[model samples]
Target chain A: MSRHRARRSGLLRAVLSLGLLVGVGVSGTMAYWTDQATVTTGQLAAGRLDLTLNGQLAGPGGSTTDTTFAVGDLVPGESFARAISVGNAGTVPLDYTAVSHTNGTLGPGLRWTVVAGGAASNAGSSANGDRTGTCTGGTTTFSSASAISANAAAPTPVVPARRPLAAGASETLCVIVRLDPSAPSSLQGATATATFVVNGVQRGAP
Target chain B: MSRLRVVVLNAGALLGVLCVLVAAALWVTGSRPLVVQSDSMAPEIHAGDLLLARSIPAADLEVGDVVSVVDGSGVRVTHRIIEVSESGAERIVRLRGDANAVADPDAYTLSRAERVTWVLPGVGSAAAFVDSTPGRVTAIGIVAGCWLAVVLPRRRAPLHARPRRRRGIAPVLVGAALLLPAVLPGARAWAIFDDTATVATAPLAAHRVVAQGQPQCRNEGGLFGVGEYVRLTWPHVDVRYEYRWEARHTATGEVVRSGVVQPAGGRPGELELRSSVLDLGLGATTYDVVVHARLRAAPSWEAAGTTTQVRTSAVLLGLGVRCA
Candidate 1:
């Protein structure tokens, strides 16, 4: 009788092991049940988010390559405007703002303004000409005219109306820089060059 | 043969159990293993580093903490907090990547933020791959393979077979391994949730300064006779600068006239010099009048002085100005 009992116990242990193995196998496919079909939404993959500024004036929908620009040779009451093409080169959408840095004695008298999706009049060229320009139509996203101290301290948003530039989309940024008409004449013949940096971040809440 | 079968079964069981437990624990804790894709945060947290972040109340957050926030487009960004402002029940947080030059352009208003609690450098790439479709398929295949390997072999031998003490420890080891990452979040809760501070900078842009006009030449009465007077006007001038004008006979190379003029009352801005030129002694000879001005406190990168020169010949009686 004891021999029979031991044999039964051995058989029971084998069955339990087999059940555990089957359970593991069944678990893999158990995510689906009867009368159900998998509608694959799509494969999952990681994406990148990036912002690019093309100072080359490469035209609308400009090259997504990165570059820089310099606003030079300005006189009081004169302004210079450049159409910088800002592009979203990454797979994810992003919004961007512009910050200006001035270096030289003439820096104090210079004013920066950025307009998005607008027409620039008498836009200044790199070569010496009339150094005055203005933006019309679109939106005046930032103007250092009224709040010089407060404006200089904070970054100015370019696309306030239709922000969060979609991926693969590019927009023309009319960067208008003018020397204050009231600037003292002492700032003349002295150079104050500027660098405009476009800072981008993932789109924020609506 | 039976000994070999037992070993394979035990090994397969160990692997299968580990995979399930670890995967389940990750899901239960709501932990996401993200692979950083940019070098915006460097040195301490770099691109390709695997980050495990846990959620915390926004009100509990303070400045200087590294957190992950979701943007409107559903993108997760990891950055350090530079500012935190409270508006009623809402918290507005400004963030900047450790490696970025400026704070992020947009601020986040949230009730909760996912603060990074763990970092495993250089492991993000592998984790990213494993999270992909092909990688998940491969993992499932591996688990299924282990299950099959453990279950296939059957032994019909003696009854009351005792399990080895060494074999019993495998489950314990697997349990511990799976529990480490899960338990760490709670065990070192304070260390993982601590906040860190950061700084920001604001800069202004300027336009270029160009010259619209230059110095000119005119005739003026001198001590000796009718002399050539040169007027030099500069757009930029400092209070401490002094302007000097000198004329030399081009033919004989002799210094004709030289004098210094001080700025009026230590004033800054447009400075001018009006000086009469002395005759070249040689009748009707051409001479060059040059103005040199120096700034006492000019910066090291700038030229200490500026020079302007104009060439002219005597016109109205030997000292008359006639620029050619």
Candidate 2:
């Protein structure tokens, strides 16, 4: 009887101990899991844009500005050219389309032409004695404008170059306008406006 | 000694030990509530409510189920599920609060299973207290005392004495010790699972200028109407905006002119009047442009109580036009 009682007591003690240990383990794990469940996963989810402008203008009257120019009293057959630059300041490469519009005149003695070293040139004249030009260019003088007008019927506006700007990269274009001395000086001080558009297409993560 | 007395004493000790063991299990597994200190969940759960939550298989959840989840900051929240989705084998749940008109910033996904279990209403305050340094030290001292009491030898009492009835108490004491740590606040555990693998790619949209201090604008049938006021009540935070304008050929489902707007302002207050126009290239058509805005705030921890917090949001606006 004593042996049987001792064996039973030992068994009960073992079972109870095991149960206590298991219960403790589980409770601790539950607490740990609760804390873990409260954590969130962080993700990369934002983008930004940066911009910078570079370039200088040179004209017949020795006037210069940052991408702007003014010339007066140019004898017919006189031409001036300025350099303009556009740069990409963003971390991603930018594929952009640059469009230019003009509101002046173009005639026999006064006309504008655009030349792309490796691309096509676009030229158009307005009935109001104004002409607009557009052209696509690549690196290294992608596009150039030639203005030749001496006693031209109207003032000629040069088209600006449109191109792509790689991330952190810049491209420059040569803009030249010509005046014909034979062209009536009445067309003097005629102004041409040029605007450039830079567009970026957002890309998804790989 | 009477058999009944011995049996009763042993049973009581066993029960006490079992309770402690259960508590210890809960502690080790990290199934405890941390108090909420904001009114964001008001009405349903107050700022002081003890939120008992557990992470389970997201697939098991349905819309309208109240669940506790972690947000972008790793802060836990108890909200109602508004959307449930399964992409492949992964499950995701979108949650919103009864007090919030819109869904949360993003979806809460169960990438792993270790979530909350039960919320003991007012027990959060006690849990919070136990999480403090002094409380932890006191708990450790009690546990050490219990250990000493069990290991030390005790004089044998008279077999027929009433006080001898408590001799089987060591097990009960141990069980209570185990349970104490489980209920302590600030316990943490993680679940192991597969990682997030899919990415959704979409084009950027146009920008919309919002007038500060006024209500947010909503688009209905091609017109903007004033809606509820939404502001970055937190000071010194500038909101960044991005939008996409899409016009569909209502009859053909053809999409045109994904106008992307990049605004030029970095101030805290509302500035200019900017419009995102959809170019209906050839034919007149009605279009819906869904705008998703993501705002990131950069507030210093110390300055959090002060000003200069950042806030961001995405709103959808609609436009209608005819092309001849």
Which candidate has the top score in lDDT? 1
lDDT value, residue B226 of candidate 1: 49
Per-residue CA lDDT of model 2 for B25-101, tens digit only, reads: 44566455445433334456544345555556666666776766555554455666778788755668876656443
Question: What's the C-alpha lDDT at position B101 in model 2?
Answer: 32
Docking class of 1: incorrect
Instruction: Provide the overall lDDT of each model, using Cα atoms, as 2-decimal numbers.
Output: 0.51, 0.38
What does candidate 1's lDDT look like per residue over B1-324, in tens digits?
Answer: 556544444444444444445445545775545556555666587655667666788898889888877666544667889999997777899987775556665799989887777787666554444444454454445444444544554455566767433334346346546533321111111000101111111222333232222454433444444454544555434343445556676666677777665657544233222223455443445655555553322211122334344454445554545443
Instruction: Choose the strongest candidate by TM-score.
Output: 1
Clashes of each: 10, 60
Q: TM-score of chain B, candidate 1?
A: 0.48
Among all windows of 10 consecutive residues in model 1 chain A, the one with the lowest summed lDDT is: A33-42
Minimal lDDT window, size 10, model 2 chain A: A55-64
lDDT of 1 by residue, A1-206 (tens): 24354334333333333322332333233222111222122222233455666533221112232223444444345676666666777666766655555556666776778788766667445333345677776677777663233233553443444455788898777777676766664664555445455655545322
* Model 1 pairs whose backbones collide: A72-B208, A73-B208, A74-B208, A74-B209, A79-A132, A100-B204, A100-B205, A186-B269, B64-B196, B64-B197
lDDT of 1 at B286: 63
